[model samples]
Target: MATEPSPQRAYRAACPNCGAAVEFRSAASALAVCSYCRSTLLREGEALRRIGQSAELFEDHSPLQLGASGRWQGAAFTLVGRLQLRYAGGSWNEWHALFDTADATGAALRSGWLSEDNGGYVFSFEAPPPEALPPPEALRVGAAQVLGRETWSVASVTTAKLGAAEGELPFVPVLERAYVVAELRNAQDEVASIDYGPASEGRPPRWYVGRGLQLAALGLGGLREDSTRELKGRSVECPSCGAALAVQLATTQSIACHQCHAVVDVSKGVGADLQHYAQDTPGAEGRGGGEPLLPLGRSGALALGAGGTRSWQVVGYVERCTLPEPGDDEQSFWREYLLYNQKAGFAFLVDAEDGWSWVRPLTGAPQLGGSTARWQGDSYRELYRYTGQITYVLGEFYWRLERGQRTVNTDYQGPGGKRLNREQTGEGGDAEVTWSAGAALDADVLLKAFKLDAGQHAALQRDVKPLSSRGIGGLAGLFLFLLFVVIVFSLVRCGRDDCAELRSLYGEASNEYQQCARNTGGARGYGGSYGGFSTGGGGHK
Candidate 1:
């Protein structure tokens, strides 16, 4: 078992700009921001030099704070500093964690980073690249690259800016400066990122590798008390309508005004200029139904097998649709409710025309090849490929969202009711790929989980059942009836290729083909529906 090392003496200095005492816990930390004056200070030997002014962090009301302690891999660590960064979509935080462990020579303490984006978290440590890596502009989503001794798939390539800094940081942050970040993952559930600090600086890209972090298992302490209560108490006046809209989640970057139905941008915090945009209300023409079955703020407990059961509340809702294909005239729409748990982060509850499912963005990328995808030890077969677009949204979201935001989606069906969905957004080097995995949820199970009343359950239940559920007797009777009709049709000289056309058009596995076979006095079979919406962004990749 791993162990935490004994506490060592720390180097103390006075801030050059603020003339306040600043403490450095780790010998490796090169810079520190004065908590009193927000001065960016650089350490040279034993003296501190004022570099620049560190921007104040936007009020995110995050539960994790400086001095918070947690154990990872049996080693204890403390949250010492944070760096807040913003991209085109939204923002995220990388909290510096100074480990209470020593280096190989026992001369210095080690450190890692606790990344918090949207609601997801990952603790990573800096590592040396096996070889020279290409620039961020050369990495494309879904493409494979060799890193170190393993091959990894490019997950996301984002250009972000340093928005703020707080507490103490290992390096000085160029306030409001832009940089490129590229993320990659392997089949072994390892997530890695390459950070190229500001293009103008010409600094070598730094790499960090780690796995998904579960806060419940970390045994973290010293978190902010009543963080949710503080978030609930905060309200901001809508720029478009004068109505007060409450920002429910501490990580909320985008929220829709309840009164005017306009989406508000609070990425820079409510104190900054709040950007608002007009959008049509849900249930409007061509956008499908707007209201969600599980209303926002509704709490429920979900059992995710080995992941255990956790209570979640609906904090955000979105309506998405797949427009008609080249020759198809019908459109398929679905609803997704973003469920939030204080410790477990976020999960999506998707309600499609087929049925219901609960999915969460995966930190590790699954291996994809040809017509199959493999994750962990399970395998999934490709089901549907389509283009999905967000048509409407309600409540709060962690990323900047706009109407008609589109992505290319491919869904896969796995054994034991498991499902996998992959969504790719943006173009070329700017593209981002995200994967979500979950199992099908029965309406009755959800009805019980949410503790909904009879009326709500009745309205929510879907009539999607497999033909095998009808029992042996009912199947036998139906098969005999179909055979008799086929014989009668043959005797009447019905067109021989009448049913063949449908089989070719809709395919044998489709619901349309099964329905057509039943209606035309033929025998095929009906199966439960499969597939889900492709929701990308916000989640930590």
Candidate 2:
């Protein structure tokens, strides 16, 4: 078991602007915001100078706060300051964690950062930057960069602005200012972020390297109580239907109207006029069903090997289909359910015709080859490639999801029923790439996880076959036999009678007869085959 560290000596001073007591816990901190008057105070040796007034922090409903204590590795740390940053898509928080360590002089506080990404946490510490760091404009998405002995893939190049700041900071923050930030990742789940603020000021870029981590693993204490109480019960009226709808997650940007099935945009917050657009309900046009097997707000306990058993809830649902290829008559459809856990973050449960699988977005990029991929010492073979489009959506989502969102996907199969998938959105410099990894989940396990009744479990079950065990010849024969049976049934059922004239003209089981029967609406399940049986899009942010 881990524990927090003992209290350390701190420098106390009076705010020059407000005359309020100001404190700095870390010796390296040069700036402190006055809580009494929102004054930005800059420290010059023993003197304090009033720089400017700091902007008010946004209400992000974050669980962590100043003075929170936690353990990192074998060291104890305390949260001292925070910076709220915003990009075009959304906003996140960067907390300054001061670790208690011993120096030649005595006990000292070291500075690190804990960044909030999507719903997860990233523990990062400053690293020595390379001799020359490229500018944000020169760094392209999906491109590779080499640092020392490691090769990293560019994950994102965002133009982010400093929204607000609180508590003590190591460096003075330029409030409400825009700067370039580039993130890179490797195959080992390590992430590196380059801040160009220093470079813009005629200095080398500052690099911070770390990996995705769960909050529970940090052995944190003094977390905010009832962290989600205020946001969870918030409600707003639907603009389209005028029905009251509850907004569940604070990070949710879009939600669907259950009354009218209109996609409502809550990105501007529920306090503003909600924007909505009507879309056709999937399965209403006689296509595949769009109803989710798992109901929203339903909680389940999933046993994830070394991750242990954790409770997750179904927060969102989406229906997606592959675009019909040339000369193809029908499309393949699948549904994805968004599962959320406060501590574990987000994951997706895909329900395809073949079976169900659990997957989550990865923080690291995998090494891709011509037709193979390597990640975490495992290899994967290509299985399918297609373009998936969102057909329908319901419930809440973190991203600004819209109907007809498309992505080019490449899926791979690994050992022990594991799977890997890559989805690319946009093109060139504006492109964003995401990777997901998981394994095939059993239907019975889900049943147990959700504690479903027998009837519900039966409906959720899929007829998963061990197709790999069957030889290629056996699969071909089985396909031919099923085709023969469908043709025979179509011939007999055409025109509500045995079509003797057609049978004599094109033989008992000819292609021409089968085509005629299909054209006349006699052949069942003959429209088209589901191409490659894909996992629907959900995990990608």
The numbered model that scores best in lDDT is 1
Off by over 4 Å in 1: 1-8, 104-106, 281-290, 428-430, 464-541
- TM-score computed on alpha carbons, candidate 2: 0.81
Model 2, position 179: C-alpha lDDT score? 74
Residue-level error in angstroms, candidate 1, position 157: 0.9
Counted clashes in each candidate structure: 0, 0
Clashing pairs in 2: none
lDDT of 2 by residue, 1-541 (tens): 2234343557789999878999887777889998889899998887799999888876657788888888888888889898988766567789988877743446456778898756777888887775477777888877778878788888777677887898999899997666777888789887788988734576667888887788888888888886689777788899888988888786777788888877888765667677787764313322222456788889999865348789999998876666666787444556688888888878888776567788777778898878998998999999878777766677988777655667777888899988888876666544666778888888888888887787887566554342334544776767756765565444222113243467578864666654444443322212111222122121111
Candidate 1 C-alpha lDDT tens digits along 408-442: 88889899889988888777645778788898888
Residue 318 C-alpha lDDT in model 2: 74
- Alpha-carbon local distance difference test for all models: 0.74, 0.72
* Model 2: ten consecutive residues of lowest lDDT: 532-541
